[model samples]
Target: MSNCCSSSSCETTHPKKHRCPANGSEYSEVSARTIAHHIRDALRWRPTANRYFFCDDPACDVVYFGDDGSTILKSQLRTRVGVKELSNDELLCYCFGITRGDFIANPANRDFVMAQTKARLCSCDTSNPSGRCCLKDFAKPEM
Candidate 1:
């Protein structure tokens, strides 16, 4: 799938404004379209025969499956999907897109992991002064 913002024009007139989907939390999937896009994004990386990433936004609290396969394979992702310890093994895992399961050595995969993490951290929050959110904590976590 193309990037979440790809031709999405999910953008709004007010840069900080985030459209909340009626289905769930303002930070999570605001609509079916958002969910679909994320699922597609997850599917784009699954190299195995039938592996998938599961995304449940803390904002929305609604669990949706990034089904690279027919069904939601939580068992597989939680059980089989892992940080590929073996050398030169093609794999993929979803740690909310922060960690890449593909050996953690492949340059392209490294970029992908970084991008995902960045995207997740991208401002989608509506609680900020700008009515948007961010993954990174500008403030100290300990404070």
Candidate 2:
């Protein structure tokens, strides 16, 4: 037995339907293989700025490197956001003007994990919930 397919001459006979998007952009599902082929084009470099999140929270902003334990997300770019090798803590300190303590206080901002970095999230001073009061930004003494 042989199978048969038909060529259509009318819109009503078409097997698929497409709708115009209000956003003026057309979207359709693409096969995984087709997407993988464009990996190089998708992964291109762009301009960047200095490290760290612009955190205003006092606790999060002024974190330093520790000799023990892992490399946490502090004093660096937003690691969560690709193209930037920083952490949320850095943003709190530099970009947005927040501190590590205050930034950590807000649980929602805890976006990504940091390891093998200079700064990372540390235990907040339980006695003083407001990291602003506990953590102060002081210039490191010249060594």
Candidate 3:
């Protein structure tokens, strides 16, 4: 997938103001066309009509929104969906059955895990409880 904001036009244009549907947090706009195809497909976005808005609030469930005032997609909405606020002991790499504790135990293993993920060898998109790639989640520093 392409970088989240690699397009020149996206860089030059000012982001439109919007609010998160989940938490009413304000955010800058991002064109749906500029986001990765997989993300767009997963969100089922209509590029022409819906402008994308990203929310960084961890407590908020809605991550992306449409300019039409619709919630296009969400993350960390429910535990059943496999999106949860992970604790230190919780598993981090569902595809390979790796946990945060496992990574702490063997920090060197991170590289191997990342390589497998990058190669798409790990079935995170399907197997992961969140129904999304684990790499981005893993990359975040533990809180």
Candidate 4:
């Protein structure tokens, strides 16, 4: 499974459900292979685990898991991956290194940025820290 942020169709047809042991928050399963590639160093891949989960809570860092019901902590996870909520100074566009502050400071640039992203002007799949596209998050009205 590709990262959900990569494209509009990243959602699973039948998301495997699990309750977070750390937070009791319900989460859907994602591909272990995808998670492994995203956080290769952080994850201790379990041969028995077929799926993994990502805790979207910014306050939580329990990002990766395995089939054997194990998890990887935030400290083990990669930094600057854009998986966490963007701090004011953090890059929203990992490919172009555009920060949230840049957009807030100049709202007009948002459209231009969106246009560039929609046109596939950059290699987001390879360049993005999350190994996904920014458009799904960037194009949100709340952003």
| Model number with the top TM-score | 4
Candidate 1 overall lDDT versus native: 0.31
- Model 3 poorest ten-residue lDDT run: 75-84
Model 2 misplaced stretches (Cα beyond 4 Å)? 1-5, 9-30, 40-143
Assess candidate 4 and give its lDDT. 0.62
Tell me the lDDT of candidate 3.
0.59
lDDT by residue for model 3 (1-143), tens? 26647755565345566787778878766555434432534465445445666565656666556677776444322222222445556666777877776777877667888899778698764455434566666566654
- TM-score (C-alpha, index-matched) for candidate 2: 0.15
Q: lDDT by residue for model 4 over 64-139, one digit each (tens)?
A: 5554678876666565555466577767677677777776787666677678877879665555544456655565
| Residues 78-112 of candidate 1: C-alpha lDDT, one tens digit per residue | 22222222222322333433222233344355454
**Can you give the lDDT of residue 118 in candidate 3?**
75
Ranking under TM-score, best-scoring first?
Answer: 4, 3, 1, 2
* Cα error, candidate 3, residue 107 (Å): 2.3
TM-score of 1: 0.21
Sort the candidates on lDDT, descending order. 4, 3, 1, 2
Q: For each candidate, what TM-score against the reference?
A: 0.21, 0.15, 0.46, 0.61
Q: Relative to the unseen true structure, what is the C-alpha lDDT of residue 143 in candidate 1, on a scale of 0 to 100?
A: 15
Q: Which digits, one per residue and each the tens of the lDDT, describe model 2 over residues 36-106?
A: 22223324422131111122222333221122211123233222211122343433333233444445565
Deviation from truth (RMSD, Å), model 3: 7.5
**In the order shown, what is each candidate's alpha-carbon RMSD?**
14.0, 22.4, 7.5, 6.7
